[model samples]
Target: MITKDIQVNCSIVERFNSLDSSGRLAHAYLFVGPAYIGKTETALSIAKMFCCEEKPTAGQLFCGQCSSCKKADSSCHPDINFINSDFGEQIKIEQIRELLAQVRLRPFMAKKKIFIIKNVENITLEGSNALLKTLEEPVGDSLLILTTSVPEKNLDTIRSRCQIVRFLSETKQDLAEHIRTHYKEDEITSQYFAYFAEGCFGKARLLQEKKWFEKKNEIIDGFLFKGWNDDSIKKVLEDKEQVKEVLDVLLSCIRDCMLIKHGIGQNSLINVDRKEDLKGFADRFSFDELVAINGEIIKTCKLLSENLNLKIPISVIKEML
Candidate 1:
């Protein structure tokens, strides 16, 4: 789809149009935002607009019917390439080398060749330096779009060469509406999905598909009152991905509970799906206890992200409870 079709803040769209229209668009562009919040889609739209055969009418973006747009959107165009690791993973040295080798060649159909590198933060130290030369002296016809959840990891020099675009996500209500438009979810369940997504539409869709809110609430409730037992942890370990998602949602829940205890009001709770139970537990647990629990959850999540032993963290959390 074209850039105009995307539902994002107007400031971002306006900035892109201004740059592209004035012919001042930078060769290396950095998209700063959280994960699963449409960064990839926005980058793809930019690639399509750059590759469009005809300049689109004002306010209208790349025409999807055009050959260039179709090829780019479908990711079949030789000129439009996505540089990431195997299995849509990281930005590795090999991927960067292959991208560098490809960009040296001429465009297949479009006037310019575009590279969309997802998660620029994942670019290795070696890969970053390798891409540095390309970013320093662009072929004038080649464009690089780098998307990252955390832009701090990118080298300062690399960031200076690029035009940074910040993508703000929709509010809870907005995400809920998008969910309702695309799915058959009820109002309550849809709101829960939005709350769990933490204002990320793409994440909202995935959690909606998995009905993760249901699992999240169940897990939190079990942890508070019933507490986690061997059989319960065993069942959770059965699905590692869902277990990870559940832990993330659980951490958010504890954070909300902490806020509520500090008198932030019920509406401010991210765990709105079970505000009463969460508040009750928050009241039962002292402020220090709640804070410590939240810290452990966050620490555990961080360890998991680094590919640590999951059992050890879970065991620590169990003991803390």
Candidate 2:
């Protein structure tokens, strides 16, 4: 069932199902949440509900036995279109123009044509401007579903045209329980993932699948002990996605060091497992050095978001360290 595919956002799911059941669905819906928080999965589930030939009678997921449901579940539905840009790339104006042409066509099988665009924030300025008309006035049998991790980055004109649905992050307890039940993990392992993920199920799953937790710890240790060099910086910043992850982990480790320096409780630290190492690093850096490093990290993150180079910002952080 589609609901089984969603590990969180139960309330939002129930409300959407009710709306669909009553035939009062919105023409457009903006699903907003943090990265790896099931926004895409929930959006796909809603799409299934809309496409299902035998819709759920109660406030539940679509009937899996129906032909339409099976097709949608398998991602082979002709009427449903999934649009997303390549990693670290914007959705170009050409893509939006293509989408405009596709939306004019009638649904081949289902009653409505569904378009699911993921990471709408990555839409270029020209692309967003081109998309505004359809968002404002859609065909009766067409539905648009947009999902984004950064809502603030989207145009206000576009956001004002659609209904917004916020997906709240789960509590540590709830997240841990979900991981324990769904992933078939023991309590301790589940708790670790839940804490490190900070309430995002997809992130927790990724961390487990990629073993990033240990890898990130190793990176932090290398940065603190061996210190940053040209070769190390080059290797870490090689990939765009890896650069983001590395920067995030580096920032967290520095934050943990700051907490230790301030005599803050260990519970507030993001890298709880590396508390002792963080403390040792904290002693080496003066308060001023830590502050400078933190400021550089903030700047680096902003630069990265704007598709700028990371070498300089990263090098500055290294100099401060």
TM-score (all chains, Cα) for each model: 0.79, 0.79
- Candidate 1 lDDT over residue span 1-321, tens digit each: 234443344455456657878998778888888888877777777677667888777666666678888887678988888965432366779889999998898887877888989888778889999998998898757889888887877789789878888877678898888788777677767777887777887777777677676777777767666887788887776766756876877687778778987889765666666777777767777889878887888888887778777777777777766
In model 1, which regions exceed 4 Å deviation?
1-14, 54-58, 86-90, 180-184, 225-228, 235-246, 252-266, 275-321
Model 2 lowest lDDT segment of ten: 1-10
**What RMSD, rounded to one decimal, does every model reach?**
3.7, 3.6
What is the per-residue lDDT of model 2 for residues 1-321, given as tens digits with 9 covering 90 to 100?
A: 346665546667668768876988888889998888988777777677767887576646677678888898788988888886544578989988988888999988877888988999889999999999999997767889898888988999989998999888899999989889888877656766887788999988988898876787677867767776689779978777777877788888888888888899976777777778788889998987888888888889899889898888888777777
Report every candidate's CA lDDT: 0.76, 0.81
RMSD versus native structure for model 1: 3.7
Residue 218 lDDT (model 1):
76
